[model samples]
Target: MARNIVISGASSGLGRALAIEFAGPGATLGLLGRNSERLDETAARAREKGAVVRSAAVDVRDRDAMRSFLLDFDAAAPIDCIIASAGVTMVTPVPGEVEDLTRAEELFDVNLNGAMNTIAPIAPLMRRRRAGQIVLFGSLAAFAPPPDSPSYAASKAALVAFALATRALYRADGVSVSVVCPGFVDTPMAGSYSSWKPLMMSPEDAARRIRRGLDRRKAIIAFPLPLYLAARCQQWLPDSLRTAAMLRFRAVQRLPVR
Candidate 1:
């Protein structure tokens, strides 16, 4: 039997890639995104691949709406895997400039609280059944604070801890939780970065790796082995050396116009 999957942020980027990667006969997909046009496009593409797709233009930050969408989808087709991939990124300010407070708040709201809204409600249902997987999309940025985007780093860092704790809490209950900390994946989201992104992998490739990791039930799946190793080693560097190395990591884009 094909697995039933739910993915937040399915309008584009890694979320859309994963939707395509998981699409096939017998597979049922529930996708939630903030853009109706793009969400519909994604649904059409997945349907082409023979997957039964249900999509909604819904914001992950809207707790009630998200809860309703997730619960309703679960009732229709019990979700085997629920991936929290909806997120927004803020670029770092140029020299002598302060980070935008509003952008920072929005960052936390979407990347952190929004993720919680997307996955938390579904967790208890999965726990009760003792069957299901919850996957949180983290980032390589979580390993070390980048000089460019403090809030972005903080948000992902929180998820790293949360994902691990959640995994430990539900492991014995047959509910598997995994955190995927991908390196620079070539997606619209990563395009927001103006600095050099080393060891970037295509969304398609990254999705394959994540799916493989999930299949094996790995608790944490961080990828592009070389970059993952570097992120792990970065924290061990001397303060001065790390600061100098991280100088190249600044974000150059301004806040998106409303």
Candidate 2:
């Protein structure tokens, strides 16, 4: 029997790539994205790979809409895996280049709150089934304070701790949780990066790594070894020193917008 998998943010970048990678013989994919065009593209690609592709064009922040879709999915087929990849981020400076209170709220709504909405709907089903896997997208930016992308950084960082708690709560229920932290990916999301982005992997490579880690049921899957190591170094430093270092890191991206 083909296993049922749900992917949020399936319109592009890592989520799109992941949908393609997982689509193949014996896979039933329920792809969700906000954009209809891009979602169609992803579904087409998945279908080409012999997977059963279905889509729901709904914002991740809409709790009721998400629940409606998820319940429909559960009724049609049992979901075996769920990847909550729907998130938004930007390097655009707040209160300046892209200063809008509404944008800031939207960012949080999608990145953090949206994640909860994405995961919560499917979690009950997984818990009831007593078998499932959840793969959350964390980031190297999640490791440090990102003054330039305050909300984005905070969301990812918060997820790290959230995953920790989730692991404890869900492990005994036969549901495994894995949080993937990729330093930099050459995706549309990070294309605007102006500063150094080391050991960046293509979307394909990142997707492959994500599947491998999930298959192995790893608790934390951080990649591009060197960069992951670099991020981890902050843990060894004293809090005062680490805070100072983080401030410097954000300072480098402080050049005035042209």
Candidate 3:
């Protein structure tokens, strides 16, 4: 197990569950999230499990702040694992309606650039030590881009590719990189979607699987065998057929009230 770990998006959903799952005696956790109160809650839970926890209410999209937070945490204790799990999702509001470009841009900023910010700062440090693990959170949508959430799917697909390339590049340095492509998870984010969610998993179960995958240094940790297979299969279908099939499951994402 990684003794010193850093996780972004640690306030809620799979990220929060992962933090709790990894917490225990001899572990040190550095957590980051946008919500201060919720981040504190996560830290408290980790502390209860006997892990030393440090938390920050910082947005992953701010590169400078993320770099500072990651570097400071690493300086205090050499980080063994870094999980870039911060992301957001949006969809076309209705059939034939294009998504707002501003919203799409914001989604990309969070899902893709934010992940880059979270990983870039500490990558070299880990390489110098010749030890570290990096995990990027992707989604099943990467395999089969959903019609309703084009930007969301594209962002995740880009992450999957980035993870693959980075994994290869860092392998020689003893730094391991893994990407997680999960199906629907019963998170508040997922709750916004009203479409049928096949094989939806609880955050705890998802976290356990992710932890196990990281322990083994697996390159890609996709879950729910059925959904994974189905997504992969969609890639081989004709473009029109694929799009039509995806339309059947189209869902509108309800933005949370501020």
TM, every model: 0.96, 0.89, 0.97
lDDT-wise, the better of 2 and 3 is 3
Best by TM-score: 3
Count of clashes in candidate 3: 0
Q: What lDDT does each candidate get?
A: 0.88, 0.81, 0.92
Residues 1-258 of candidate 1: C-alpha lDDT, one tens digit per residue: 228999999999899999999999999999999889998998999999999999998888899999999899999998889999999887756555656898889889999999999888889999999999999988888996677778888999999899999999999899999999998888777776577788888999999999999999998799988888888898899988888878877667743622
What shift in Å separates residue 107 of candidate 3 from its native position after superposition? 0.7
Across residues 185-246, which tens digit of lDDT does each residue of candidate 3 receive? 99888987677788999999999999999999999999988899989998899988888878
| Model 2 residue 72 CA deviation in Å | 0.8
- With candidate 1 superimposed using the best TM-score fit, by how many Å does residue 180's alpha carbon deviate from the native? 1.0
Rank list by TM-score: 3, 1, 2
Clashing pairs in 1: none
